[model samples]
Target: MAKEATLQVRMDADLKEKAEALYRDMGTSFAEAVRIFAKQSVQENGMPFAMTANRKNTYGRLSGYANTKLAAEEDGAYEREMVGKHEKTD
Candidate 1:
């Protein structure tokens, strides 16, 4: 058996309740969810799921603006234009 590492996280009360309810519905515990996430993170180099529940709050007005089709198109165009724009010639 592998040794277990403990992690302490602080989360919003409402979000915690929602996560706990969802986990219970799936017949799993919050700790199980954390373990699964950790396992995935270790296997893959990135997160297995979108954990940014506070995206809208964190992004503020930009969140709503970015969700629109027009904004998405514009964002893609901007990103493509910016990519490889500053390559070093060493």
Candidate 2:
């Protein structure tokens, strides 16, 4: 017999409910989806998906902007605000 490990994650309640519903509609539970992701990542030796930055968010506004530094700072501030807003609280 193989030993099993438990994984714990904290996420927003609404996000968790939405993900669970999505996976259930796909004929699997969210936990199973996570297992599938882990197995695929192991087989691929890394993420099983490609990641790309959103070009509009990353560069579109900066085009011909006089102060790129300020633009980047504003972007960072916005990201931080969003993260704080969505972070789970116990």
- What is the per-residue lDDT of model 2 for residues 1-90, given as tens digits with 9 covering 90 to 100? 353998998867997999999999999999999999999999999867653344455344435433668666787787788788888551
lDDT of each: 0.72, 0.77
Tens-digit lDDT track of model 1 for 1-90: 575677887767897899999999999998889888888988887766444546555445335435477665786786666664644322
Worst 10-residue lDDT window for candidate 2 reads: 57-66
What are the RMSDs of all candidates, in order? 9.7, 12.3
* Collision pairs in model 1: none
TM-score per prediction, in order, is 0.50, 0.56
Poorest stretch of ten by lDDT in candidate 1: 58-67
TM-score result, candidate 1: 0.50
How many clashes in candidate 2? 0
